[model samples]
Target: MSTLIAIAITTGILSGLWGWVAVSLGLLSWAGFLGCTTYFASPTDGLKGIGLSIATNLSGVFWAMVIIKLSSMVSLEIIGYVITAIVAFFMCAQAKKNWLNFIPGTFIGSCATFASNGNWQLVIPSLILGVVFAYAMKTSGLWLKEKLEADKLVEVRKN
Candidate 1:
């Protein structure tokens, strides 16, 4: 169980990174791909967010209904695809220049996850984990920048 949890956490982090990259590239289709990848990669709380975003952004409630019905017959995993498609649709609608503008998507995704799951425990943990992962990425990026700067200075001194 512990190992499974660890795997889920790691998968979530990777998914976030994928999502960040996809958004940065400003590719709506790839964003959907990333969202789907993230959902399928981790059997974690994040799926709840993916689920809601997809549901909200889909063309119509009819499509959403079909997805749910088909998902029940085929497998629960299909739910992730349905949700991802919806998110992609919404992202396409927005089409902003700055894809890495994480605030809107993050807030919307987190809220959607909570609404969809209606499980306080899962939602709470997901929120905490998502926030942590975001901050960790920021901090790591900063560290990388400092390390590169230090390396450059050392090379200059040697020269």
Candidate 2:
């Protein structure tokens, strides 16, 4: 598990670095991508954020493409958005890796991209950063827990 996690982090770091390069070169917009990435990357014990973010973002990309292609078929714009939301919800609810958190993850990824002018390219890096940072957050929490427990042990011994 540790080795797999380390690899995941390494992959995210490499992808995020490339995203930075793209931003610096003016090849991409950094605003929405970075913002969404940071918000979703919040670290926790089980890396749930990263998992959910990845799944949601990937689905968001697909939905964005579909909406772009299909929205014109409908006379009502709101219907298109509703259709998207329903499909997104269904997908999120079905995701096995993140079934528990699928709702927020799907909404965040889909709505964020939907609002970002349907730029899945920009969404990719944000997803990477979000996933990697989630790992970092989990690791930090574990380390902090260990240190606090050690401190309690020391205090008990001194008494």
Candidate 3:
């Protein structure tokens, strides 16, 4: 099988499994899917991608929480916008760190948190699980492709 085909199969299967698991656990599957997408979209692959995805994702959640808390403390409508601007600056600035360099991951995480109404409880697990699923899908797909190639090579040698 082709590498793309293998990856597609794994992604499809894992996506279904993740959906079922998320619904069973009462968590938002879409949030998990966002994390998975972020992982795949990350510049680096393997453990580096996982680290970048998780770190940036959590940072986004933290920033969102800060915005929520600060917004609650004040009544001015503009304060929310100001707070978000500051947080956005920090989010981008945090890329100086190697693990938190994925700026898009942070944005995705922040959006997920906001969508969940700042429910870190649900967002955290969902994103982390999604990253894990992405890793599994990638790893398994690669393995499957390699196995198929090896089998093909052996057949060629016999002929």
Candidate 4:
């Protein structure tokens, strides 16, 4: 539980910081950076999870700026993305899921920002892709867990 909370706080802070930077630089929002960073920060264990947590949280701060760039809706974007990400992270962590948890927020944040920019072209695609990615991650994580368990069982039998 503590770990999950840490992840949410970390992701949110990163998101906000990135948002601020994006807004300052006149970038359309930090969605691209957010996505890239999330993928990069995927946790393999305690050490990697710590680093990824820091990176992911800070990336979310950038989403605030993304909202600003897309619709001049800084507050909405911040609230929407931050709340969703925090909640999703906690829930998914408790459920022991991985990147699957972040998909909804990413999709919503991306689509919302793009939709505000009058770029309807990207909204649907982003949402669809997010869902697909989430599904993939969920399945993969479960598969890996199963394999690990099976390996452990084999070792125990041999012992």
Candidate 5:
């Protein structure tokens, strides 16, 4: 089977499993999906992707909190926008560091935080869980593909 097909199968299976686990644990399923998506979108694969996803996503959460806190301190609605803009600048600027270079991951994290109304307690764990799922999906899919290929080769040899 193709690598793509293997990944698709694993992703579908994992999504269902994750959904059930998330609900059982009272965690946000969507937040976990966001983290999983962030992992796949990462520039690198394997452990690097996991690290980048976690780092960038958490950084986004931090920035979102800053925006919320600073904006809330003022009466002007424009202050919120201004704070967001400033935070955005730092988000992108932080890309100078290799680990934090995934700008989209940061944005996704920030959006997830905002969506959760800055509930770091729930969102943080959900995001990290999602990254773990992504890693499992990728690794398992690749392993499945390899196993299938090996089986096919053995059959061909016997034939």
Candidate 6:
């Protein structure tokens, strides 16, 4: 199975399991973010992919809180774009290495903050939980793949 598909299934289960929790804690609100981040971060850099995503998730949440707080001082409807640009620029500047796709991943995580109406307190926890779940889902997927497809390549090539 594809890693992304496995992630989707894992998070869906988690979401259904956590429906009683608030939006911020529910996987339904975060599975997409986690899947996209894992997809972009897992392409290369091997073990470092998870580390890169961890940093991106945390940074994304922090920038989100910054934007949300700034929303109180100005028009988020407009200033939100400006803040997004600045944050994107800042994140891209430091992403010259394996994390070149970090911007999109962070955007996914950061946007979750506003969507959930979450505060800074949830940033660290959310990021941490996301990273942990993403990793666990990925590893479990690889294990399942190896176990089930021990003899088949199972590679899907599109031309």
The prediction achieving the highest lDDT against the true structure is: 5
Better of 3 and 6 by TM-score: 3
Q: Each candidate: what lDDT?
A: 0.43, 0.58, 0.93, 0.43, 0.95, 0.60
**Residue-level lDDT tens digits of model 5 in 12-68:** 999999999999999999999999999999999999999999999999899999998
Best by TM-score: 5
What is the C-alpha lDDT profile of model 6 across 101-148, one tens digit per residue? 566666666766667686546545555555555565566666666655
**What TM-score quantifies how close candidate 4 is to the native fold?**
0.34
What does candidate 3's lDDT look like per residue over 1-159, in tens digits? 888999999899989999999999998899999999889999999998898899889998998899889988889989889988998999999999888889999999999999999999999999999999999999999998999899999999999
What TM-score would every model get versus the actual structure? Answer: 0.34, 0.56, 0.96, 0.34, 0.98, 0.61
Worst 10 residues of 3 by lDDT: 63-72
lDDT of 4 at 132: 30
Clashing residue pairs for model 3: none
lDDT by residue (64-157, candidate 1, tens digit) is 3444455566556867687757754644454342332233443344343434443333333343334344434434445556666788899999
For residue 13, model 1's alpha carbon misses the true position, in angstroms, by: 7.3
- True lDDT of residue 43, candidate 5: 90
